[model samples]
Target: MGQRIFRRVSLGIMMCVLATGLVFAGSPLPNPPHKGEGILTVNIQGVFNAKVSLSPFKGLKTVEPIATVADVRGNKSAKIKIPAQYFPGEFLLRLDYRAKEADAPYPAERIIYINQQNIEITVNPPYINNDEKTKFNSGEKENTVFSAFMKENNAKRMPLDLLRQFLLSYDQPKSKLYTEGVKEFEQRRVEYNTWLANQAKIHSKLYVSRLFQFQYIPAIIWSGDAKERVNQILKNYFEGINFSDPLIIRSRELSRFMDGYMGLYGMQATTVALRDSLFTQAGSVACEKASKGDPQVYGWMVDYFYTGYESYDIKPGITMLQKHINNPDCFTSKKQQITQRLESMARLVPGALAPDFTMNDNIGKSFKFYQWKPQARNKLILFWTTTCSDCLKLVGELSEWYKQPANKKKLDIVAINLDEPEVKIGKWKAVIANLSSWKHLHAEEGVNSPIAREYAILSMPVMFLIGSKNNVIVSTPGTIEQLVKDLK
Candidate 1:
C-alpha cells in the first residue's frame, strides 16, 4: 500500500507528461516580452537542428508550451523568453533533436524550475539529466536546492520505507525482530517527517518547497488486518496537509495525493455495490476535508470526484455531490457541468419527456426531434461522432440488429453526429452513406451545441430511448443488449 502511493505519484507525473502538447513557433524570440519575464538559454550539443520548448504546470490538466525555438543547430543555442504569467514554478524543457543530420527527430524532456532569474542550461538531448552531460548555471537557486533536497529526502526515506515493508510482511510478530522493526519504523518515520517539515519551513519561500509535504510520511497501524490498516491510513492521510494553501494545486503531487486517497477506498471494495458505497463515502470525507480550506481547492476536490462518479455511472456518488456543488463558496470551473449533470439526472430519467431539439440532417433537412413520429414503438437517439471507435462499433452492432425485421419494427434509430472542427463532416458523410436506413444529423458546434447541452452529452456513444407516445425517455441503454432487454 505504501508502495502503491509512491507509484501513484509517478503515475500522476506521467499522466501530465502524456497529455502535454508542444507547440513550435517559427518566429524568433520576443524582443522584450512581459515585464520581468526571465530569459532561458538552451545550448544544445551532439544534435543538429533541435527544437527546444518550455512549458509550465498549471492545474491538474495538460500542459502546453508557452515558448519554443526551432532550428537550433548543433553547438548553437536557442534563447526562449519566458512569459511572466508562468514564472515562479516548475517548467518542462523539451528538446526534439536528431543524432544524425538525416535521422528523424527524437524528443527528450526534463523538468526545470524557474523564478524571475535569467538562467542558462546546456544539455546533450539524449542525456538531459546526466550530471556530467547536462549543466545548469552555478548561481541557480530553485533547481539547485531542489536537486539536493531530492537526493537527501530519498536517502532519509529509503530506510523508513524498507522498515515499513518489513513490518507489514514480517511473519514473526511475537519475536524480538518484529518488535525491533516496529520501533525502528516509528523512529525513522518521525525523523523523516521532522526533517521534511523543517526543510519545508526553511525553503518556504521557494517554489519547489511546495512539494515537500508530499514526502511527509503519515502514521500507520501495523497491528491490524489489511482493511483495518486501510481505515487507519484513511484517518491519518491528511495529517500534515494544508488544503488552505491554494498554491499546492500547482504541483503534480497533489493529484498523486488524490490518487492515494481514492485508492484507499478502492482497495477496500470487493464488489461493485460496495465500491460505489465506499466511493460515495470517500467523496464525502475528502470533499469535507477540502471544503474547510481554499475555495479553489474545495472546487478541485468536487471536480475530481464528479469526474470519477460520472465516468463510473455512480448515481449515489453523484447525488452525494449535491451539497458540494450547491455550496456558494466553492469555485470549481466544473460548476456548470455538475449542475447540468444533476439536472440531466432528474429530467432524463425513465418516463420523463425527452427534451425537444432541432438539428439538420445529412441532406440539409431541418429535423425537429419531438415533431417527427417514426413508424416504430420507440425512437433511439444516439449522440455520437464518426471518429469515436466505440461509436463506430455500436453503429455496426445497431445496423446488424436493425436488419432483423422484428427489431426494426420495434425501434427507430436517430444518430446525432457530434463531429467537430468541420473537417470531420466529410467523414460523417462517408460513414452515413452506408447506414441509409437510419436518420443522421450533425450538431454544428459538436458537444457545445445547444442540443448536446440539453441532453447533457458529456462523452460520445450516449443514447436515450424515446417512447412513441410523447417522446418520453423509456430507457437509457448502454449497449444493444441492454436496449433489447429494456424493450422486452
Candidate 2:
C-alpha cells in the first residue's frame, strides 16, 4: 500500500510539472527569449497564422519580401524570431494576416530600422501611437525619418490635388477661383519642396527616392498653367531622377509614379491618337534616356514595361526587352528571368494554345489537362500548394462555387496540388477532404512540376481557364468571380 501511494504521488508530481510547462509554453513572453544572437523578436496578438516578412530599404526599387515566418498562430500572443542580416538600414516589416481571419485588426504593415541591436516589436490590431502600451519612441528619430517624411509629404499633397482639379475644371485660365487656387498652390509648393529638400540634410540616412517623389510630384503638379505643366512634365519627367542610384531603379513606386504621370500628363487630351502619341513618346524617350545615359536604368525600364504592358494585352516594349536580354551588360540570371517571363506571358495570353501536360490524380489515375470533351463545358486548371495559405483560401472559394450544381456542369476543375513527397500526403488529404468530389492531382516533383514550368507558376493560387473547343486559352482569372463571369 505504501509503494502504491508513492507511485500515485510521483505521477501527480509529474502531471503538475507538465501542466506548468504547458502553461509557460502556451503564454508567450512580451519578447522572445534573447539567445544572445541577433534574432529580432516580434510579439503578435489578436491574429493567427500570419505571414511575417521584412522588405529592406537598400535601393530605389521594390524589395521583394524576405519571409521571416511563414504561418504563426495568434493564440497566446506568438513571438516571431528573425535574425537581422541586412546592413544597418530601414525595412518594411509586413504581417500578412490574410491567411488567418479577414477581420483581424492588426495593421498589415510597419516600418522597422535595424541598428545592429536586437529589436522587439509587439503587433496588435489597429496599431496606434498610444493605446495601452508604450508610446512612440522618440529616441529612435533618425530611424523614423522615412515615416515622418511620408506623413509630411501626404499632408502637403492637398495643394497638388487642388491644382490638378483647377487644371481639369476650368477651360478659362482667367477664372478667379482657378487663378487664386493655382497661385496659392504655387506658394505652398515652393515651401513643400524646400521642406523635402531639407529632409535629407536633416536625416542624412533618408531614402532619396522618398524625398524625390515628395519633391517632384509637387513641383510638377502644382503649376499655375495647364499647358506649361504638361510641357514641363513631358520634357523633364525624369529630370531629378538619378537612374544610377540603385534606389530609384529598384523602387516599384517610382515606376508606378511614371505610369501615373503619363496618364495624368494630358488629362484633357483632345483625341485618342493624341493620348497614344503622348504615351508612346513617353516610353520612347524613357528608353532613349536609359540607352544613352544609364544602361542599368534602360534595362530596368525595359523589364518594367515589358512585364507591365503584357498584362493589359499590349506588347509595346518587346523589342526593348529582347535587346536587354541580349545586352552584354545584363546579368545572365536576369536575362534568363526576362526571357522566361516573355515566353510564359506570351503563351498564357488569351487565344494562345494552352500548354498541355499529364499528371496522376489523387486515385493514381493519369490525366491529360488538354483532354476536354468537345460537347462538354470549359476547363479550369488551378495550381496550388498544400502549404500556401492563399491557396488554401482559394480552395475554399472554389469549393463554394463548385457546390452549386449548375457550376459543376458548366465548368470542369482540374485541381493540382504541388505538395512534395516528404511532407506526406496525409495532411494534404485532410486539407482537400472538402473538395473530394472534385478531380485532384498531385505532382511527382512538387515545385518542378512540368505543368508549373509550362505555365510558369511564379506565385501561388494561379488559375487558368481554357475554352472547350480546341482547348483554346481563355484568360488567367484572378478570382472565382472572374472565372464565373468569363464562363458567361
Candidate 3:
C-alpha cells in the first residue's frame, strides 16, 4: 500500500510540472481566450509553505480565478485559473502568505497579464539590511521596489509601459515622488519630441501621409515652455514650407489643437498668433471645412480670437476675431465683453489727458495734479521712487542737467515719491537734499492713492509733463535724455 501511494504522488507531481511548463511557454504568444472563445488559464508554481489568494478583478466581472493547492515533496504550490473577458491592459495580481518560521518568508510575487498574449512577471523581495518593520516603512526602499518593477516590466511593454509607470508615479500622494515622476515624464517627452522631429525630417513626405503627426505636434508644444528652444525647433521644422506642402496643409489640425490648449490656459497672445497663422494659411476653405463637420475646432478658434481681442488692443488680432465670430449669439456675447474691456483700456492710453487725482504730500498738504502750479517755464511731474534703480539713475542725470545753465531756467522737475512708509522715504529725501531748488513730495497714502492707479503706474521712473493748461504734454518719454531733447 505504501508503494501504491508513493507511485500515485509521483504521477501527480509529474503532471503538475508538465502543466506549469506548458502554461509558461504559451503565455507570451497572442492567444488568450476572449468571450465565447477558449478560456485563459494561469498555473502558479514554486511557492513553498505559504497561503495564496487571488482578488476578484473589478473591471471584468466574468473573469474569475480558480484556486487549487497541491503538496509535492513536503513543499506546497498554488495554482490559479483566470477566465476570459478581462481587458488587455495591466491588471494587478496580488498574493498573501505568512511563513511558519520567523526567518523564512515567501520569496516572490508574480505578475500575470491575460489577453490574446499572456505575460507573467516574477518579483523577488529586496534584501533589507535593517529590521523588517523598519524596512516596510522606508520610503527609499519602497521607491527601489517600484523602480525595479518598472525596469523589469518596461522591456516587455514599449512606450505605453513607460507612460503607465509615469501615471502611477504621478498618482502617488507624496510631493517628492510626484515631482520626480513629473521630471521623468518631461524628460521622456523631450526625447519623444526629438525622435519625432528626426523621423519627420528624414521621411518628410512619407510621414505627412499619416494623420497622427498632426495630433503629435500639439502635445509637443504643450510639454515645453514657449521659450527660445521650442521656437527654434518650430522654426527649423516649418521654415520655407508653404501651404501647398502636405505637412503644412495637414498642420491645420495641429493649429486647431493649439487653439484649444491655449484657450484652456488663457494664453491670449499664443492663441491669437496660432489661429491667425492658420487662417492665413488655410483661408476660407479651412473655416468652411471645419464648420461643416468639426464644430469643436471652429468653436475653439472663435473663442480664442474673441478672448484675445478683449485681453489686448492689437488691431489685427481684433480683425481676425471679427471675421471668425460671425455667429449671432457668440458674436453678441463676445462683442459686449471685448467692448467693455477695450473702453476701460482706452482711458489709460498714452498721450491722452492724464486723469485728475488727489494725494497727500509728506507735510500733510493735499496736492492735486490738475490744481498744482509750478514756478518754472514747464512743470514736469516726474513720477519716481527711491527703491527704483532706474529712477535713481535718471535723477543723477537730471541733477547734471540742473547744474547746466541752459536747462535750469527752462525745466522744473517735481519729484513724486511713490514709496510707502515715511521712514522708507528717506532714500528719496537724501538723494534730493543737495538739489534743494527742485520740489519733492511723497504720496503718504501709499499705493492706494488714486493718482497712482489712474496713471496705471506699474514700474518706476515714469514721467509726465503738464503744460500750462494742465494737459499731459509728454507721457512716458524714452529716457531722461530723450525727455530733455523733447523739451528743447
Residue-by-residue lDDT tens digits, candidate 1, 74-110: 9999998877767666678899999989999999988
**Each candidate: RMSD:** 7.2, 16.9, 24.0
Q: Estimate each model's TM-score.
A: 0.82, 0.56, 0.35
Off by over 4 Å in 3: 1-137, 140-345, 348-352, 357-360, 363-368, 421-423, 469-472
Task: Report the number of clashing residue pairs per model.
Answer: 0, 11, 3
Pairs in clash, predicted candidate 3: 30-116, 31-116, 32-116
Q: Write the per-residue lDDT of candidate 2 for residues 1-488, one digit (tens) a residue.
A: 00110011221121111100000011111222233334445666665556677776532343666546766666433333444344344567777674356654344766565543455656663452322541233354433555566677777765565555555566776678767776776677667556655654555443332334424443444334556655555565655555444334433455544554445433545664564455455566766556654565666666555444333223344434566567665432346655765677767789988877887788877787666453346888888887777677778988988888887878777788777785667878887777876678887677577777888765567788887767888888866777889889
Best by TM-score: 1
Candidate 3 per-residue lDDT over residues 178-295, each given as its tens digit = 5665566567655644544444354332212222233232222323333432333323332212222222211233343333333322322356456454333332333333344334
**40 Cα displacement, candidate 2 (Å):** 8.1
lDDT minimum window of 10 residues, candidate 3: 18-27
Number of the candidate with higher lDDT, 1 or 2: 1
**Which pairs of residues have clashing backbones in candidate 1?**
none
Q: Which candidate leads in lDDT?
A: 1
Prediction 3 global C-alpha lDDT: 0.43
